[model samples]
Target: MFTRCWLWIGRLLRRTLLITLSAGLASGAIGYCYYSLKFSGPVSAEEQIPATEAADSRAIIEDAIRVVEQHRSDTRVLRDAHAKAHGCVKAEVSVLSELPSNLSYGVFSQPGKTWQAWMRLSNGNAYPQFDRARDARGMAIKLLEVEGEKLLGSRSEQDFVMFNHPSFFVRDVAEYRQNFAAQANGQQVLAFLPGWDPRHWEVRHLLIALQTLSPAPETPLASTYNSIAPFKLGPIASKYRVIPSPENCPSYTPPAQNRDLPNFLRNALYQQLSIDRVDACFALQVQLQDPTHFMPIEDPSVEWDEALAPFVTVAKIRVAAQDFDSREQNLFCDNLAFNPWQALPEHRPLGGINRLRKEVYEAVNVYRHQRNQQSQTP
Candidate 1:
């Protein structure tokens, strides 16, 4: 009777184990199928810009620059006042790594290894007393080593960029402007939603979901970084991407406090430099299809058809260990401006938002820099 009971119990256990294994396998397969269907789409070539549109874009940018210069006096005073209100600190720094081969705006390569770089890391909002921990961070890098045809005679090759989610909030220029206007108009909530808000829901939700899955600051940075701008490549155009290697540097759980993020990243970077002299590499990818055939250009809310133009590794960017934040590294230089228009003729930025940027970026930077300089004089 005992032997018979033992045989029955073994049969029951085997059935339960088999059922669980089958369920797990089924779930995984379904998930894989869903993603495969989602990201894999068809590819096509991009369209050429009409002559009228190109001329109009250039004129708008030129006019805007002129207007900005006219108001430079008032802008300077306002900037000085702001600096006085908030104790401004300045610092000078240098780049420790070599730039990628295709770093030039065009074929013109500026000569110089060492560059006087300035940077500023700040929250998205303009509140001076805002908690650094709670706000989104910004990073700008200005290379004093740059030389080119002066866009309004500025001698610096400034890349005013930021570290937000991997993808951008908007896909094209028109949407980017609308989103910018909303932010400037004190509609903070509008920045996060669709209609009046410029935020891309898909990208935002994906990021929020990622945070819930792994609530860490480093996780977002570790993933791929992309240039939302539709950049030109010969006759083909694409959105650029930079992916970090997870193989060398494994992802870690982030500490709870928000303010600790910058420091944590700084420390991690320092530790890597101390040991292996860390090299962060990202490859450039381009979309080879007509914008109209895939995603809507004016809507910053939706993602481009990734299925059409899968990311192909083109260039590699490697950042070395060096203190990026120092006293002389003011926010202006450190928070380098990266305009889509600041490109080679081959990689000219596409869409309406990029056209607007050719003006807005130049105006904002010139205004901000002029003010900072005046305040430093006294």
Candidate 2:
């Protein structure tokens, strides 16, 4: 079955490659395509919907571990899926002074409360690559000195993870398993193929993957990111997002094109925080799920209709002027791990993908920390 899938992918790539090359000379879309190819928003106001576990979830997690371990073996370094770190900077997450009753939950429960944080911006790639390469971007915020028992460990910290896109490509454990298997074989394209398994095909997923791997952002601070999966916000469920304050954050235009400066994203960030001494601000907003509507907890691929439930700003994230590019700081950022499960029970991660993450993320985190000879977070 795998051989047959490989042959089909080979044939498709062969045809598409030629057409892409021919079309590249004119459109530049295909030209950009020729250069390289790669790589959610989440919300809700209704009651918390519990997630169901797939029978094969354990096997799927094991397969994911294998995939991560394979990457570690190949690079001789343990790393997360989002392996390329752009930068990690000091910041603060401050709950707004006045949030409505419905919006008041978990971290936002105490209005005006502030928690110091570390924000790590990264490329969502299996390996470190040029920043110019088209891929998904990540913004992981870890709040420190938070007074709550974490779901993962006995840490007084909380983590909120987000991606630039609104929805995830993989819907369930089965699709996730297929994706990891493809990654294990070093053929990510196989995960998006029409018929990786004879009985199954994922055209929508393939298109979503293509869209997810859209153009890289100029600077990490200038882009909006969504928590593409749903999570608990006390009694109700919600999806949160980080929206950069355009008025406060300056847009960065590199002196040279992306081709000339492969690490332009990092350079842009450095310029804003270090050289320019500009402070960056972002609105932390949440959209509650509606119980009347069908917001599938099992399938993260289906985006909840934002029109029905709008996001309300509940907090602000502010990054003051500071240099985070030093070797010590970068190493600390590299060693740090962020997981949705590293949160209060009030903000528990939902859905099969998140459930899968509970196991898969832990396996990789433990392995990576062990390999690096570092202590696990308490």
Candidate 3:
């Protein structure tokens, strides 16, 4: 009996050692390949170029349209190929005063600037998906009737889109193209493999980041949304985060009896809005430095370290009390088109991901409108 136990322990130890050795070798090889592709020198402010060229932008846009073409054919449902709205609510964005000079740009220039905004919250899936599934949540805001020269020619509205996570799964449009290509082909494993590879250190780093994830949130108000990608703040670059105001904030108190609801998240928001008004705020944070190395303006995968420059409250958002859950309101949300490109030039989005978004969003609108037979309006 003693001899048998000794043999069993020896075999287990050997197995563990073999597994560890294999993992180390795989990691080392992956690291070597990852480092091979890196640039040795730092990018200076002068050296910094626009995130995307016209050619690349066109290519990314075409790729996105082609990929979604199959999806449109398959579903025949009127929806954005990305986030499909499950909830829509109205809000007021009250611009705060006495901000630092650097922060006082574009929309924040005036102390008392205010706009009537519509908030369209959605599940980050192509269809009206089950709410209990683990997926990213989207917050699309359209700040209306603001007097300004806008990016979406002759329009005065500023549109902002956000996700629950702070960093993107892919760093740029090229990386995302491959992932989306794989997705369109119904071979999502292709996208998953590169991130899983031991050789792709940058991707591994993104994998380790909390921002590349979205846990199932109990309610839209309870979950925080991040702009993940940066935007040009006058001459500076920055990101945004939105959360519920501390006073009478929405919560996640689930009843003991109801555990298996398919649409819990949507239901949760409706219940709260049904009772009374909801309030929330948006915090604008600036990027401290160009950070030539890791935290570059071009990389959406790298999280800007908050330790360098903490965020300041440059703006506050207030959601008005209303029956936002009604069918009429939901349909209203569907008709609206929201994009970061629909903004003032000062707040123009900056980054490869954002550049990709410019074209992808347009393509999405075209596809969505064609499918739904809705009027194509900018």
- Which candidate's TM-score is highest? 3
Query: All models: lDDT?
Result: 0.44, 0.79, 0.69
Question: Taking the tens digit of each residue's C-alpha lDDT, what string does model 3 give over 65-122?
Answer: 6655545534454444444665788887877867788888888888867778888888
lDDT for 171 in candidate 2 is 80
Q: Which tens-of-lDDT digit does each residue in 68-129 have in candidate 1?
A: 44444443422211111111122233222343444332321332334443333333333333
Structural similarity to truth (TM-score) of each candidate? 0.52, 0.81, 0.82
Candidate 1 ranges with C-alpha deviation above 4 Å: 1-163, 166-186, 190-216, 219-223, 246-271, 274-277, 290-292, 296-298, 330-332, 335-337, 374-378
Candidate 2: segments with Cα more than 4 A from true spot: 1-55, 73-76, 193-199, 248-259
Q: How much lDDT does candidate 3 score? A: 0.69
Better of 1 and 2 by TM-score: 2
- The residue-by-residue lDDT of candidate 2 on 1-378, one tens digit each, is 999999999999999999988777766665355423411223234323333355557776666566566567453455658888889999988999998888787778898999899999998987778887789999999998878778987888899989899989988877777776675677667666746574466666777888888787768887899998889888787889999875655554434335457777888888878988878899999888775665666677867777888888888889998999999888788788888999998899987788878887788888778876777653
lDDT of 1 at 165: 39
Candidate 1 vs candidate 2: which has greater lDDT? Answer: 2
The residue-level lDDT of candidate 3 at 329 comes to: 72
